[model samples]
Target: MQKDIYVVGLMVDERSTKAPDVQQVITRYGSNILCRNGIPSPSRERGIITLTMEAAPNEYEKMEQELKNLHGVTVDCIHFSQQESFQVCQK
Candidate 1:
């Protein structure tokens, strides 16, 4: 119900092989994603992606699950509610 800020950390394995499918899922939820940053491992076989999101709870949860469903992906998240975010800034 409270939609504020959500951070999704995505770990991708075999970048060249798995990225397209991962990308498809991301594109489906593109509107809710505020920004995305992806960094590849030095070997270029793995990647870490961070996404800043603002969306309804269910929407983002679904996105998280979909990413998790991928074979070579790992997902993690951090959430901040609207009031909590303001409180943090004021501190």
Candidate 2:
């Protein structure tokens, strides 16, 4: 069996209004997250967050869905195979 790497990209508009909720969900899935990076826009009105994760398919989807449910937040995921030479399995 081959292991998979999951990369999630999150764009949060209206940071002041949505960051708390985003933080809550990130905390809920803390164990599955391998790395996290967050950057705020120059005007401090929005934020971009990227996460590297290792999780079962179901759990990953659940986390993505949770983030999507929040207003002013957009989420995207990329899946890569660890056994291959940087092969991307999904986007």
Candidate 3:
């Protein structure tokens, strides 16, 4: 099995009401997380978080499912695999 790199984005609509639960779920999957960055909305009522990680397909799917189950949270993910390569050329 090959592991892939994934970037996950989470948006919490009611930060004060939902942040704690979201944090707990994130903690439960701490080992799979490589780095995390979070920012609060200007009004302080919402939050956005970005996570970078390396995980097996199943591991990521499970985390996505759990996060999606939260009432006021939205999750999105982008994955990069070893089989894909990118290059930039200037003309």
Candidate 4:
């Protein structure tokens, strides 16, 4: 098994999709959103949504691929924390 990862999802829309649109993405990806922020987009009718989530290491790639394919949703970045391995000292 791989180490757990932290993923950030950004919803950038040229034209905002409704609630169903956003929900659909979450459902499809099975991602647990940790935090979210929304702001009005100056260039278009849509707004930008930023979200953070914890992803299962094994499933990270699949989740990212699915999310990117969703309408009005794009992954801005994916961040991961290195898991340190420790060993017991023997006398």
- Residue 41 displacement (Å), model 1: 4.6
- Give per-residue CA lDDT, model 2, range 1-91, as digits (tens): 3336788889999997899999999999999899999997767888999999887767877888899899999888787655554443343
Off by over 4 Å in 3: 85-91
Candidate 1: lDDT over CA atoms? 0.83
Total clashes for model 1: 0
lDDT of 2: 0.84
Candidate 3: tens digits of C-alpha lDDT, residues 1-91: 7878888889999898899999998998889899999997767878999998888878888888888999999888777867775222111
Candidate 1 per-residue lDDT, tens place, 31-91, comes to 9899999997677789999999898878877888888899999888787776665322110
Candidate 2, run of 10 with poorest lDDT? 82-91
Native RMSD of candidate 4 (Å): 8.8
The C-alpha lDDT values of all candidates are 0.83, 0.84, 0.84, 0.58
**Which portions of model 2 show Cα errors greater than 4 Å?**
1-3, 82-91
Count of clashes, each model: 0, 0, 0, 0
Clashes of 4: 0
Error of 3 at 28 (Å): 1.2
